[model samples]
Target: MTSVKSSAKAFVSEGALSEIVVKIMDDSVVEFLVGLGFVAVPGKEKETLSLIAPNQEFKVEVFSRLRDEGICFSVGPDWCPAEVFEFLRDQKKLTGFYRKIVWEGTSTPKIIENC
Candidate 1:
């Protein structure tokens, strides 16, 4: 995984209560996700983050930040908690959950979206 040396910008979701928007300052989001203890979903694109589960507090913190920031987006069903993710990881013998990040692809890479 890439190292997370640059700072991260957390954006509040405008409509979505479940998803949170975190602006990745570095070129890669993989590092940021790894730092958070979330892993990429198997058989899926690393960019298309999918985790086993995320707790309500974790969800709320992200969603709330995005909402507070006035970042608008489509809200979906509530995400499962971290415990659930842990269970699935243990049962399925999976590595970890996925964390999505949107890259700007500019000289100074900046994240556009985070899930």
Candidate 2:
């Protein structure tokens, strides 16, 4: 008899923004989020991710929600370069808002006050 090793595959929802909140879960989930256009922001202990809205209208809609919830984030023009912004705009990948969320503290990620 031969013994074989098996690995469990992490399940991720395609094109789901909530999926990106699991960045602290594991590398596989992180990879999946990245594939869906989530940009990883460098942090010390917390993991931050930003998603560029497809257009200005969509950006406003989402940004208003984030602001209401008091989540830590930055708009596109705040962090993105002009050239990159233009490129993403041309590709219809970004608008004026960058929806950024920071998960902080413990193994279980949770939304906390802005850092």
Candidate 3:
């Protein structure tokens, strides 16, 4: 059977609709956090994440070692918060793109470019 993706119009519950809507607005928040170099793995329950950016260079350092975690998080102006991508790009430690290995079933994260 084919998988059904989540749609924008879908609602999980009537009573939780408002919160769900808010969550949708920040759907990419997790991805953005992950892209910044957090070891955000799937199947792990997470309520909140603290992105530790001690310096500008380490802002995106999370992505550098995240490949070992087998994570696939979203990014881009269309999918993620625009400011987030910009912040990650601003960090000299991080390259523009990193490999997504879990769904792609790869052993490495690809570096797209230098920011």
Count of residue pairs whose backbone atoms collide, per candidate = 13, 0, 4
Ranking by TM-score: 1, 3, 2
List all candidate RMSDs to the true structure. 13.4, 15.7, 13.2
Candidate 1 versus the native: TM-score?
0.31
lDDT of 1: 0.35
lDDT of 3 at 52: 43
Q: Which candidate is the best by TM-score?
A: 1
Cα lDDT of model 3 by residue, 42-96, tens digit: 3443333434456544534444443223222333333332234344546554454
lDDT of 2 at 31: 55
| Root mean square deviation (Cα) for candidate 3 | 13.2
Query: Which candidate gets the maximum lDDT versus the true structure?
Result: 2
Better of 1 and 3 by TM-score: 1
Question: Candidate 1 on 55-111: residue-level lDDT in tens?
Answer: 555654443333343232222235432233333345553332322222344544332
The Cα local distance difference test for each model comes to: 0.35, 0.36, 0.32
Error of 2 at 99 (Å): 14
Regions of candidate 3 where Cα sits further than 4 Å from its true position: 1-45, 76-92, 95-115
